[model samples]
Target chain A: MLNRPASDTQITHARRLWLYAVAVLVMAFLILPTFVVIPMSFSDSRFLRFPPQGFSLRWYESYLTSPEWMQATWVSLKVAVLTTLLATPLGIAASYGLHVSRVPFSRVLTIALISPLIIPIIILGVGIFYLYVRLGVVNTIPGLVMAHTILAIPFVVVTVSSGLQQYDSNQELAARNLGASRWTAFRTITLPQIRGSIVAGGLFAFITSFDEVVIALFISGGQNTTLTRRMFTGLRDEIDPTIAAISSLLIVLSVIMLLILVLSNRQK
Target chain B: MSKLSVRSQPIAIRDVTKTYGSFNALENVTLDIAAGEFLTLLGPSGSGKTTLLMVLAGFTRATSGHVLVGSQDMTRVPPHKRDFGMVFQNYALFPHMNVFGNVAYPLRLRRVSRSEIDTRVARALDLVQLSHLAERPIDALSGGQRQRIALARAIVFEPRVLLMDEPLSALDKNLREQMQIEIRNLHENLGITTVYVTHDQREALTMSDQVVVIDAGRISQKGAPREIYERPANAFVADFIGESTLLPVQAGADGFAFGGRALRATVAPPGGLFLVARPEKMELHRTDMDPAYNLFEGTLHQLVYQGETVLAQVALPEGQTISMRLTSRREVMAALPEPGKPITLALHPEDTVIVPERGQ
Candidate 1:
C-alpha cells in the first residue's frame, strides 16, 4: 500500500510543467481577440480602437438608445429563445427514437437529421432563402426562427445521443417489470438520469441561434433584422464603435454559457 | 405483517421456441412450476436458460407457445401488465433515487397511499436488514448492499412470481454463499413461485427445489439437486453438474459393461454408453481387489494434495487415466502408493452412474 504503481495517466500537476505553458499559449491564441474588443467598446473616438484614446460609455448609450439597434436586439433575443424551445424537444425525440427503434434505415435517418451541420452555410442560406420566398415568409421573425432552429437542432441531437449511449437501457426494463408502463418508465427512470445532458443541449441550441449570421442575412431584413445581421451590415458600411460594444456583450453571454456547461458536466 | 397478503401463482410454459434467424435459442421448451416452488434454469452462457426466463417474465415473446399464470393465458402479456417481480444481473437500482425512493417506486405507480408507501418501503427495507440506511444514496452503497437494495425494490410490491437473473455473480465467493442462504430464506418466508436463472451448478443446487439443466437450446435433465448430481441423464449433464471423468462404456440388453466388466448402479434412470466415476466417490483400494466392486487396474500417476483432500491420478492400461480423491480424515491417504506403482481403484455399485453420450 505504501508504494503506488506508476500508471499510464499523465500526472501533469507534479510532472510535465511545460504542458501547462503550452496550454496557456493556446488559450491566448484562441481567446485573446475576444477580450481585445472589450476595452475598444469604451473608446470616446468616433471609430473602434484596441487601445482607447479615452474611456467613455458613449458607444453603449448609442447601442441602447438607437431605435434600429434596439429593435434588432429584441428580434435576435425572440428568435433565439423560440429556436431553443422548438429544436430541443425535436432533437431529443429524434435521438431517442433512433436509439430504441428496430426499424430499418434508422442510421440513415440520423444522418439526415444532422445533415444541416455538415452542409456549407452559404449553400444552406441560399436554399432556405428560396424556400422562404415560395412560402412567403421572408423578412419575418417567424422565418428567422425557423431557419435558426434548423441550424440549432444538430447540437441538441449530438449531445443527447451521447447521453443516451452511456445509459443502460436495462434500467427502463427494470422499471417496466416493476409495474410501470412503458411511458411511465421512461419519464420516471430514463429522463431523470439524462437531465444534465438535456440541459447542456438546450444551452447549445440557444447559443447557436443567438450567434447565427449567414441564414439571417439571406432571410431577414428591414424590421426583422437580427443583431448579428445588423452588426454585419454596420461593419460593411463603416467602422463603428457600437458593433464593438455589442460584440463584447455577445462574448460575455458565450462565457456564461461555457460556465453552465462546465457545471452541468460536473453533475454527471 | 400486512406484506403477507401476497397471492403466489404457478407458471406453465408449453412448447416454447425462440429463434434468431437460423439459430435456435430455445426449442420446444416446456416446464410447469408448482405454486411457491423455487425452480432454477441452469445452463452455460447462451444455452437458452436466460431466454427461457425472459419468456416467463414476458420480456421475450416465444415464437410459438402458451404461458399460463395461475390458469390464465399470459403469452401476449406485456411485462408491465404481467406484475412479475424481476431482479436484473447488474442490480439496476435507480441512481437518482435514495434507497426509500427505489423501494417505493412500484407502490407509487400503483397509486398506493403516501403513508402506506412509506410504511411498506420501511418494511421491505427491513426484509433485507437494511432498514437503517433508507435515506442513503444508492451510489454510496457497496456491491453487496446494492444487491440487497435491488432485492428489496423487486419484492416491495409482493408480485406473485419473482425472477432473478444471476444476481450474485458479481459478488465474491464468501459474499455469494452468504447471499445464497439469505435469498433461500427469503423465498421460504415469501412463498412466491420463483424462477431463478444461474449457470453456477452449486448456486442452483443450493437455492432451488428443482434444477433444470439446459444444453444447446433443449432440456437435457430436470430433477432435484441430488438426483441430477448423482444420476445425470446424459454425458453432458454429468460432466456439467460435477467434477467427473466420463469413461466410455458398452450398454446392451444384457446390461452395461465398463472396462471388460459389468456395472450395476442403483441410481435414477440408468443405462447409457458412458460410466460416470466421480473422484470423491472412488476409493484407493490397498488390499486385494474385491470382485463385488467395479475395479480397474492402473499405475499411480501422481498425487495432488489440496488442503482437506488428496487426489490420486491413476493411468490405466489403454492410455486412459482416472482420478480418486482421498480425504485427509481417512488413514488410507498415507497408504496411497507412489507414482508408477501398480494400483487398484474401486467404486461401489451404488456410486457408479451410466449416462448416454451426446454430441457437444
Candidate 2:
C-alpha cells in the first residue's frame, strides 16, 4: 500500500516534468531564428554564418551610411507613422458605430472588414498594383500609404472592438443624461477608458505597415521604395550582409513597440 | 459651498406605449409626477416599471405617446437635451476618474468656472458624506460608496427631475436599509421631483410619497404607501405587497360566505370576491374571545420561528389553510398548541377586505 501511494506521487511529478520540458522546447523552437539573426548580423564574412570566425561592424556601418538604405528606411518610417494616425481613429469610430448600430447585418460588415487578413496577400498586391498603374499613381508615396492603410485597418478594428466590448456603454448614457452632448460624452468618458486599446491598435497598425513587403514590392519603386522592398531586392540581387543588420534593427524596433503596447495596457 | 437656487419641474406622461414587434413592453400608461414629489414605480421583473422610467429619461422612445416636462414637449427631445439626472442600476461611475472628477462632470459640460466646479463638487461629496474621499479613485471605493458617488453626481447639476433605477439593489440588506433612509432624507432636503424604480416592496413602501404598482405593462394601482399596503386594489396587489391569505368567498343574502359559513367584511364586491386576511391582524383563541370578530376553528399545522415572531399555519376545514403571525412573547409561546391540535382563531371584520376576483 505504501509503495502504491509513493509510485502514484512519483508518476504525477514525472508527468509534470515531461510537460514542462516539451513546453520549453516549443518556445525555443519559435524564438531560435530571431536569436540566430542577431549574431549573423555581426559576422565579419559577407555571407550569413553561425558561430562566426570573427566579428565586425561593417554591415551596420554600410546600412547606416548608404544613401539608398537611408532613403528606404525613411520611406518605411513615414508610411508606418501615417498609417497609424489614419487607421486608429477610423478603426475606433467603426468599432463604436458597429457596437451601437443594432443593425441586422452588422455581422456581415464585421466579416467584410476582416477579409483582408484572410485573403491571400499576393492576390491583393496584384489587384492593387493593377488599379494603381491605371490611375498613374504607381511608385508614389501616397499610393504606398493607401495600400499600407488598407492592410493595417483590420488589425486596428479587431483590437479596438475587443477593447470596446469591455466598456460599459451605460456610462455614456449616464453622461448624456447629465447634460453632456453625445460627442462630448464619447470624447470625455468613453475615449479615455479605451485609450489603452487605441494605443495598442495604433502600434499594431504601425508594425503591420512597417513589415509589409508583398504590396510594397508590387506598387513601390524608385524614390519611394519601402525598406522591406529594398531588403527583398538586396537579398535577390546581392548577398549583402547589410540585410542582416537591417533585420536586427527591425527586430529591436518591434520589441520596443510591443513593450509600449504592454505598458499602456497595464496602465489601463 | 452655499445653497444655490434650483428649479424643479413636474413631468406628465400621456398615453405612453412601447412595443417591440408583437410584444408590448408598456401599454397606454399615463402618470403625472408632481414637482418635488417622490414617486416610486414598484413591480416584479419584466413588469415595465423600468421601461416607464427610461421613457421619462428619454433613453427609450415610446411607440405613441407624449412626454411633457413642465410646459415643454419633450417627447422628441434627445436625452442629453432633456437635462434630467439619472442614477443607473450599476452606479455607472467612470472608472478613469476620481471622485471629484466624476461629480464635477456635469458641471464641466456646462462650462462652469474651474473654481466653481471644485466648490460644487466638494459640496456634493459632503452631502453624501464622502467629502474626505473626494480624491480617491473609483476602484478604491466600496459598492455603497460608489452608489453614493453616483447619487452625488446626479444631483450636483441640480436638474429638474432625478431618476433612479434600482440604485440600492446591489447592496446587502443592512446597507440597503441604511441607504434608503439616507436617500429619502436627501430628497426631503433637496425637494427635487424624483422618480424611483424598485422591485422590493418594502423599499417602495418606505421611500415613496406615492407608490405606483405596475403589472404586465400596465398600472395596477397608484396611491400613498399606507393606502397601497392597507387597501390594495386587487388580488395581485395584495399578494404582491405583503404576506396575506386570499380566500375565495361568495356573496350571501346577509354578507359574504366562505365554505358555507357567514363572514363579515367592511367592503362588498358585486359578484365573486376574495377576503384578504393579513397575518399580523389575526388572533388565536381557545374559548369564546369576542362576538364581534369572525371566528374559524382549525387544527394547528406548523409553527415557523422567525426570530421575533412565529408564523402559525392553521389548517381549516375543506383543506384550506391560513397563516397567523404571533409575537414570540412568553405568554404567546406558552399558549401555542402542538401540531394537529384543535384551535380557534379570531380575525377582526374591519381588517378583512373584500377585493373583486381578478378577470371577472
Candidate 3:
C-alpha cells in the first residue's frame, strides 16, 4: 500500500491531516499548562488542586488585596517599563552603527552583545550579583532596571538587526541625494521602514524583563522584590494558591504580547 | 503646467582615483561634462563606470582628486550638500509611503510650503504620466510604474544635476525603449546636467549626447555616440561599442597589411595595429566592385535568418570569422551563397579604421 501511487486528492488529504495532528499536539503541549493554571487559580481549595470541590475568587482577591503581592507587581512593572525605554533606543543605535560603519571587529562586537543570550542564566545571575554588590546597588530599583536592560538589549539588537538587514540601504542614499541631511534621511526613510522591528524589539524587551526571575532572585530583595521572586518564595515556603493567580495573569500578559507580535508581523 | 526652474551646471572631474585596499575601483579618471548635456558612462560590469558616477554624485569619495561644479570645488561636499537628484537601479521607493508622499519628500525636506509641495509633486507625476496613481501604495505598482515613480521622485525637487545608474535595467525591453525616449524628452524640457551609467551599449548610444567608454577602471574613449561608433580610439573601444571583427594588421612604411594584402587606411599606426571592420559597414560583393573598397574572400560558415536582417558569418583564410548583417531582401537572400561556399565581402577604406593595439 505504501508503494502504491495515490491520487492528488488523497495525497493532499493525507498530508493536511498529518500536519493538523502535529499542530494540535504542539498547541496542547504549549497551552495546556496555562489552561490548567487558570482553573486552579479559581479553586476553592486551600492547596493547589485541579478539578476542585468548588470554584471561587478567593485566591484572586487575596492577590489583589495583599500589600506584599501588590508591591511585587508594582516593582516588576516599574523595572520592565524602565528597561524598555532605556534598551530600545540604545539597541537601535547600536544595530544601526554596526550595520553602517563596517567596523573591522563587527562580528566580535555582535557576539559580545548577544553573549548574554548564549551564557547560562545562572552564571549571568551570579556575575551580575557580584558586580551589584561591589557597586552597592543590590536591592535597588535602578539596580534591578539596569540588570533587566542588560538582558533586554540583546533582544532589541537581534530583532532590529534583522529588520535592518531586510531594509535597502539605497533608500537612505536616495534621500540624501534629494538634499536631505543624513539624520533626516535616517529618521524619515530608514526608521519608518524598520518601525515594525523596533516595535517588536520593544515588546520583546518588556516581556523579557517582566518574566525574568534568575537575576532578580540573586540581586533583588527587601522593598524591590520582583513578582517572580515573590511567586517563587510563595510556592517554596507558604504553598499559597495566590501564586497560581499571579501565574495565570502573567501568562495572559505574555499571550497578549505574543499576539501583538503576530499581528505586526502579518502587517509587514 | 508651470515650468520649474532648473539651473544646469558644468561638472569637472580631475584625475579622480578610488582604491579599495589593493583593488582599484576607479583609476585616475578626468572628464568634463558640459551644462545641459547628457553624458553616459558605458562599460561592462566591474568597469568602474558606476564608480565614476558615484564620485560625481558625491556618494563615493575619490582617493585623490578634485570635483568642481561650475567653479566651486565640491570634492569634499557630502551628497546632501551637493543637492543632486539620483535614480537608483532598484527604484528604492519607500514601501511605507504612498506615491505622492515619496515624490514630495525632497520638497518637504527643503521646507517648501505644503501647497507648493503638492503642486510640484503633481506636476512631476504629470510629467511622468503617473498622475492617476498618486495615492497608490508602492507595493501595488508594477515594475514599470515603480520606475516611473522613482523618476518622478528624483526630478521633483528640480535639482541642478540628475544622476541615473542603470535606471531602466529592471524593466522589459519594450518598456525600457519607451522610457528611454521619455527620459530623453524630460531632459530636453528640464535641461538638467545629467550623468547616466549603464552596461547596455544600445542604451548609451540611444540616449547620450556624449558617451564615455570605460574599461577596467579607466576610460578608453569619450566622444559623441556616432563618433565613438564610427571612429573608436583603440581595439578595446572598437570591440566594446558595436559588433566588429578586429583583424590583426602588419604596419609598415606604406600602410597596413591584413590577410596578406595591402589594405587602405585613413590613419597610420605606430606599432601593433588592428583593422576594425564593423559588421554593418561590410557588404557582400560578387567581385571587387569599388576601387576604394578593400576586399576579402571567405567561406560562408553560418547564416542566421532574423526577420528583417540576415546575419552571415564568414570564415577568413586566417581562421577568423567576421559577421556581416544584410537586409533580408529577396534578391539579396537569393544571391547569397550556401554554407561552405566561397564569398567575397568588401569594406570601404573610409569605414575601415586601423587602431594601434594596446599592450602590444
Candidate 4:
C-alpha cells in the first residue's frame, strides 16, 4: 500500500475515510435508542415518545417520591448483594475443583457449571418459577437471590479461573514448606494473588442480579417486586413515560457501577 | 555463630521410591544426611535430585520406604508440620508483601509477638543486607535483591533444616556465582543443616561439603568435592564432574600401551582399561623430549582460546583425539607447530586414571 504513487494517495485516503464513516454510522444505529431515551424521559408529555414541546423533572421527582419504586430499588440492591455473596464462593469452589481435580471428567464438570449461561434465560425462568412455587418460596427475597446466584455463578467461575491461571502454584508450596498449613497458605498467598479476579467476578454477579428481569417477572409478587420487575410492569401494562425515565436512570446507574468496576480492575 | 537452638535432625531415607504411573520419578533411593552439614543432591534434568529434596521436605510422599528426620519417621508428616525452610528456583517472594512482611511471615505463622516479629524480621533482613529496603514492596526490587529477601525469609525462623532447589539458577552468571558464595557463607555462619539441589557441577562443587551425584533415579556416587573430582568412581562421575578425555588403552601387567608406547601410571592396569585424562594435566610439545612420560604423537586438529587458558585439540596417531590446555596462545606459537603439523602429547604418570571396562 505504501508503494502507491502520490496521485493514488488521495484515492486510498478517501477509501479509508469512507470505511470509518460507515463504522461511525453503524455505532450510531446501535447507540441511538439509549441516546433518544434520555431526552424523552425528561419530556413533559404524558406519552412515551420523543420530540417533546416541553421539558421537566416531574417524572424523576415522581420516581424518587414513590414508595413502590423505592422499595423495589432496595429489593434489587439487596438481591444483588446477596447473589454476589453466594455465587462468588460457590463459583470459586467449583473452579478450584475443576482446576485441581486432575480427574478424567473435569472438562465435563466445567461445562456443566457453565451450562446455565448456555440456556435461554426465559426457559430457566419458567422452570425456576414452577420450582419456586412448589417449594413455597416464590416472591421471597431468598428465592430471588437463589435464582440470581444460579445465573451469576458461571461468570464468576470464568473470571476467577482466569485470575488463578496467572498465579504460581510454587508460591503456595513454598509457603507450605515454610511452616504454613495448606489452608493458611491458600488464605495468605493464593487468595491475595487472585483477589482481583474475585472482585471482578463479584462485580459481574452483582450486575447480573440487579438487571435480571425474566426470572424476577415470574417470581416477584407485588410485595417483593424488584426494580427490573416494576419496569417490566410499567412497560407492558401502562407504557408510562415513567418507564422510560426509570430505564434512563438504570442505564446511568449501570454505567457508573460498571465504570467503577472497570477502573478498579485497571488499578489492579 | 551461636549454636542453633533447634536440634539438628539426621535426615535418613531408606529404600524410598515414588512412581507416577509407570515413570519412576524416584527409585529405592536411600541416603543419610548428617546434621548441620551442607549436602547437595546433584544431577542433570529428570535425574531425580529435586524429587529427593521434595521427599525430604515432605512436599511429596514416597511410594515405599521411610524418610526419617532424626529419630522421628517423617513419611506421613505433612509439609507444614515438617517446618523446613525452602528456597525455590524462582525465589517465590510474595508480591503482595513488602520485604519486612515477607520476612515476618513464618514468625506470624508461629504466632510470635508483634515486637518479637519486628526484631526477628530486622535481623533476618540485616543478614541479607536488605534492612533499608524492608519497607519496599517486593516487586520494586531487582532480581538479586529479591533473591536475598527470599533467603532472609527462609532462615528467619531459624528452622532446623533448610532445603534449596537450584535457588540461584535464575540469576545472571556473575550474580549466581556471587550468591553461591554468599549462601555458602551464610550456611557456614548459621550451621543450619542444609540440603541443596542443583545440576550445575560447578555450583555443587563450590557450595557442598558433600555432594551426592544422582542419575537414573539412584545415587551414583557420594563424597567430598575434592574426592569426587579426583577419583570419580565410574565413567559417569568422571565425565559429569568435569571435562575428561577417555582413551582406550591395551593394558599389560606393569603399564598400559597406547599407540605402541607403554605409558607410565601408578594405577593398576587391567587387561583392558579406559584412561581418564583431564585436559589441564596433559602437556603439548613440538619435540618428543618427554619420552619417559606417556607421550603419544599427534597432529594439532584445533585450538580454542578461553580468556585464561588455551585448549588444543590434538588428533593422535591412533585416529583418536586428546585435549590439552596451555596458559597462553603464545605457548602454542612458541612450540612452532602448525595446525596440520604433527606434535607429541604427554600425560604425567599421576594424571592418567585407569578404570576397567564393563558392559563393553
Candidate 1 on A53-143: residue-level lDDT in tens?
A: 8988999999999999999999999999999999999988889899888879998998998999999989999999999999999999899
Worst 10 residues of 4 chain B by lDDT: B1-10
Local accuracy of candidate 3 as per-residue lDDT tens digits, A26-67: 999988987888889988999998775488999999999999
Q: Report DockQ per prediction, comma-separated.
A: 0.79, 0.81, 0.84, 0.75
Query: How much is the lDDT of residue B110 in candidate 2?
Result: 89
Give residue B92's error in model 4 in angstroms: 0.8
**Model 3 spans with C-alpha error above 4 angstroms:** A1-23, B286-288
What lDDT is reached at residue B192 by model 1? 90
Clashing pairs in 3: none
Per-residue CA lDDT of candidate 2, range B147-219, in tens?
A: 9999999999888899999999999999999999999998988888999999999999999999999998988
If both were scored by DockQ, which would come out higher, candidate 2 or candidate 4? Answer: 2
lDDT of model 3, residue B338:
95
Candidate 4 at A4: error in angstroms?
A: 16
Candidate 2 error regions (>4 Å): A1-17, A51-53, A134-136, B252-255, B269-272, B285-292, B357-360
Candidate 4 residues A1-268, lDDT tens each?
A: 6345478335565457778899999999998978889998898988888775489888888888899999999999999999999999999988877766689998888888899899999999999999998999999999999999999999999998998888888889888988899889989998888888898898899999999999999999768899999988878887677777788898898788778878877877
Pairs of colliding residues, candidate 1: none
Each candidate: how many clashes? 0, 0, 0, 0
Consecutive 10-residue window with the lowest summed lDDT within model 1 chain A: A1-10
CAPRI grade, predicted model 1: medium
The deviation in Å at residue B293 for candidate 2 is: 3.0
Candidate 2 chain A vs. true chain A: TM-score?
0.94
